[model samples]
Target: IQHALSGLGYAAVKGVRQGKFFVLNLDGWGREEAQKQLERISKEVLTNPVIEEYRFEIVD
Candidate 1:
């Protein structure tokens, strides 16, 4: 997951505990584009279908 985010240009800081959250400075892209890219990245790189399923909503 960290590698995937880095590949997308996010400067990710890995947590010492367990899970990681990426802090991204997404230039001037709108929320829709960000959400779309996140989904694509998660599916293609970060997640495994055999063990996980993802669902998301745009809050704004």
Candidate 2:
């Protein structure tokens, strides 16, 4: 998809990667707190730090 789009003149969108997605349900946490928790969870459990990488964003 990335190659096809780039071939069609998409300069702004490049290096597209496909990955998995997961939605966790948590309650009572604000943006700042949720961010910290997500970071910790992502680093410690969600990804293998050595071979894999992960990122998260709040959708709600």
> Which candidate number maximizes lDDT?
2
Per-residue lDDT tens digits for candidate 1, residues 1-60, read 677666778766553234434444566668989898878877787767577776555554
RMSD of 1: 12.6
lDDT of each: 0.66, 0.87
Cα lDDT, model 2, residue 33? 98
Worst 10 residues of 1 by lDDT: 15-24
Q: Deviation in angstroms for 5 in model 2?
A: 17
Candidate 2 lDDT, 19-60, residue by residue in tens: 887799989999899999999998888888898878887978
Misplaced by over 4 Å in model 2 are: 1-18
Query: Model 2 compared with the native: what TM-score?
Result: 0.63
Give the TM-scores of the predictions, in the order they appear.
0.44, 0.63
